[model samples]
Target: MKLLKVMLSAFIFYLSFIYGASAMAQDLSQQNKQLLANFANEVFVKKDLTNLQEYLHDDYIQHNPIVPQGLSGFKQFFADWFKAVPDWQYRLEKIVAEGDTVWAYGVYSGTQQGDWLGIPSTGKHYSIHAVDIFRIENGKLAEHWDVIDTYGLFKQLGVIQ
Candidate 1:
């Protein structure tokens, strides 16, 4: 048997070069999960943080403990939560990425007349339930993890209970 047909054609050319390098690493992990969901839809639903180092990652790690770790404390905690909710909105039901991480499950409504985290003006609406996770390396957005609901946004601003 001609050397067993050259060892079964070198094991079928090494299994098609390992499935073509795992399908080119799954298309570069789905383009890094659509570039982190289009950079989280341009900074959380187009609030437009504008090119912050072309999508963060200048030591951007923050775990969201009242957010203050890097990237100017994540752009001053979303610039004081979008200047106390200047119609701030985020909806994302679910999103996920692989090898560089990227996860989201969202709903973040807003309409605060003024202060927050110090809790003051709850002039109108509120909606919480947010979850965020990001990692991404070479393409930026280095590290972040968040979970918002802050006790259902302080019980929908009734200040609690």
Candidate 2:
């Protein structure tokens, strides 16, 4: 009857609406995953900080105890570290994305050529595993929380044991 037809039409519309919303969320998740991968490839591997504003928000927040907050702070910290170890490299091992958040795990390798962590360099190479979680907002990185294996880095550098 007419009522059955109208009910079926409404059910179909509801199904389509649910699927559309799910598809949009999936698109956002995929886009964020690709963005984070490119960030690792560009910033971490290539060491290109030329267009920071394109990737990071002006008020970027950092949660690492050693690194200061804000985009300028992040840039300055990395710049100093890079200068101390000109041959630094980051190798991404894994990346995970969910909604506006992305998590990355990687190993950072570098040879010390100058002072690091207030300790004099011995010109030795070291590798440290690190994990970072980033929050994306409006297509830009807005916040970051990271954990680096500082003890491993220090021991590898012969600072301890």
Highest TM-score against the true fold, candidate: 2
C-alpha RMSD of candidate 1: 10.9
Give the TM-score of each candidate: 0.36, 0.91
Clashing pairs in 1: none
* lDDT for 25 (candidate 1): 74
Q: What would the per-residue lDDT of candidate 2 be over residues 48-118, giving only the tens digit for each residue?
A: 87878888899998888778777788888888888889999999998888889998999999999998768
The residue-by-residue lDDT of candidate 1 on 47-88, one tens digit each, is 787677788876788987787887877887888889888898
Question: Candidate 1: lDDT of 131?
Answer: 76
Error of 2 at 58 (Å): 1.2
Off by over 4 Å in 1: 7-13, 23-56, 59-70, 73-75, 82-92, 98-105, 115-122, 126-135, 138-140, 143-161
- Best by the lDDT measure: 2
Could you tell me the lDDT of residue 71 within candidate 1? 81
